[model samples]
Target: MDLPRHHTIRESSHRILDPFTDAQLATLGRALHLTPGTTLLDLACGKGELLCTWARDHGTVGTGVDLSTVFVAAARERAASLGVEVTFVQGDASGYVAESAVDIASCVGATWIGGGVVGTLDLLGRSLRPGGIALVGEPFWRTDPPEAALAIGDFVTLPALVEQTRDAGWDLVEMVLADEASWDRYVAAQWLNVRRFLDENPDDELAPALRHELSTAPLEYVTHQRPYLGWGVFALVRRP
Candidate 1:
C-alpha cells in the first residue's frame, strides 16, 4: 500500500521522479497542445509534478494516483503550493481507473506497476477517451550494452519501442527524449538525497544500505546506465 521507507528516503527531494527536466516537461506539454479544461489521469504520478505544473501552466485538471504515501502527501502539498486543484490518491495505480474517459492518460517511469510496456498501455487505455492522448515515459537502450548479462532487461531499442506501441494499436505522435545532462541530474540528485538522509540518520537501520547505494550508484550510473540508457516521454494516440 505504501512505498518502502528506503525508496522514499532516496527520492525525498525529487520534484519530477523521472529523468525529465522542467524545460523538457514543459516542451512535452506544449507538444500535447493541452487546452484549458483538458483532463489528465496520471498513474504512478510521483510527487504530482506533471499534474501540478500542467494544471498551473495549461489550466488542465487532473487526478494522480500513487502507492507511496509520502509521495502522495508531497503531491497534495505541491498542488496546494502551486494553487492548483489536483486530486492525489494514495493507492496502487494499476487498479485505479478514471470515473470517465480522460483527455490524457499517463503512466511515467512506473510501467512495471502494470507488468510492462504492453500491459501498462492497456491499463492506461482504460482511462483514455477514444482518440485521446497517452503519454508513456519509458527507457530505451541507446546502444547495445557491452556486457549482455549486465544489460537492463526492461529496456529495448527505440525502434522496438515504436513497433511495440504500434502493435498495441497506438501511433507514436511525438516524443521528448532526455539528454545526458538530464539523466545525470536525475541520477546524481538521488545520490545526494540518499547521502543527506544517511548523514542525518546515521543510526537508522537502513543507513548501511543507503550508504552503499550512495557510494556505488554514481559510478554504476555513469559507467553502465548513462551511455546505454535513453529515457523519454512518448505521445501516442489510438489508431483507427
Candidate 2:
C-alpha cells in the first residue's frame, strides 16, 4: 500500500524520480505541444512534477496516481505550492482508469506495474482517447552487459523497445533520451541522499541497510548500470 521508508529516504529530495533532469522534463513537455485544458492521466507520477509543471506552463490539467504515500503527499504539496489544481491519488496506478478518455496517458518508469512494456501500453490505452498520445518512459540497454550485470536490470535495446511499440500497434511519434551526465547526476544524487539520511539518523534501523547500499551502489553504477543503461520517454499514438 505504501513504499518502504528507506526507499523514500533514498529519494528524499527528488522531484522527478527518474533519470530526467528538470530541463529535460520541461523539454519533453514542450515537445508534446500540450494545449490549454488538455487532460492527462499520469500513472506512477512520482512527486507530480510532470502534472504540476505542465499545469503551470502549458495550462494542462491532470491527475497523478502513485503507490507511494510519501510521493503522493509530496505531489499534492507541490501542486498546491505551484498554485495548480491537480489531484494525486495514493493507490495502485495499474488498476486505475480514467472515467473518460484522457488526451494523454503516461506510465513512466514503473512499467512493471503492468507486467512489461506491452502490458503497460495496454493498461495506458484503457485511459487514452482515440488518437491520444501515450508517453512511456523506459530504460534500455545502451550496451550489452555480462550475465551477472544483466541480472540487476531487465531492459532491451533502444531499437528493440521501438519495435515493441510498433508490435503493440502504436506509432512512434517522438522521444527524449537521458544523456550520460543526467544519469550520473541522478544516481549520484541518490547516493548523496542516502548518505545524508544516514548521517542524520545513524541509529535508525534502516541506516545499516542504507549504508551497505551506498557502499556498493556507486561502483556498481560506474561499472555496469551507467555505461550499459539507457533511459528515454517515448511518445506514441495508438494506430487505427
Candidate 3:
C-alpha cells in the first residue's frame, strides 16, 4: 500500500511526531544558528512542526511535503495559526524536488520514503542548495539487539550510521539524540491518542488494530526498542 491510514490515526494528537522534545528542537535551531530568511524543505514532514516553529522563532521560511492529507491540513492550520511563511503539500515525498533549492533539506523520521537512510539522503540532496544543510532523523542500535529486536528492525550501530552518511556523500556535522525520557514521551503519547480515538470511535474500522497495538506497544517498546534503539536527527553538510 502506498498510503497507510493507520499511522496518521495513531499519531493524530502529536505535533512533533519524532522522539524530539520542543526544547531539543530549539536547541538544534540554536546550534544551527538559523538566521532570518533561511529556507527549508522538509520531506515527509509530519504536521510541519519544524517548519512552522523555525519560521516563528528563527524567522525562517519553509515548505513541507507529506503524503497524508490529514497531516497536510493540520500543517496548514498550524501555519495559519502561527502566522508563519510555510506551505505544506500532500504528496509522496520520495523524488519530490523544490522549485528553488533550499538552505536546509530534511527527511526526518521517515527515511523509508526513500527506502532507507542513504537513499533518503540522496533524495534530500535533490532539493538542497549548494553548501546547504541536510538533516536526517534515524534510529540506530544503541547496543546489540536480540534476535527478536533484530527481526523487528534493520538498524545499524551508531558508528555504522555515521559511516553510512559519509558513504552517502555528506559529513555528519551535528546531532541531537533522544534519551529515554523523550522516547517515553513520544511512545507513551500514542497510547493516550489511541485510547481517546477508540473511546470516540469504538465502531470504527481501525479500532481492532488500534486496540491490538495499544495492548502490545508498551511491552514491545520496553522489551526491545528501549534498551537497544536510539533515535536522533543528524545535520549534514555536502562533502567537498
Best by TM-score: 2
Residue-by-residue lDDT tens digits, candidate 1, 69-136: 99999999999999999999989898888999999999999999789888888898899999999889
Question: Number of clashes in every candidate structure?
Answer: 0, 0, 0
Listed in order, each prediction's TM-score against the native is 0.97, 0.98, 0.96
lDDT at 12, model 2: 92
Worst 10 residues of 2 by lDDT: 145-154
* Residues 154-223 of candidate 2: C-alpha lDDT, one tens digit per residue: 7899999999899999999999999899998888999999999988999999988889999999998888
Q: List candidate 2 segments past 4 Å from native.
A: none
Decreasing TM-score order of the candidates: 2, 1, 3
By lDDT, is 1 or 2 better?
2
Backbone clash pairs for candidate 1 read none
lDDT ranking of the models: 2, 1, 3
RMSD of each: 1.1, 0.9, 1.3
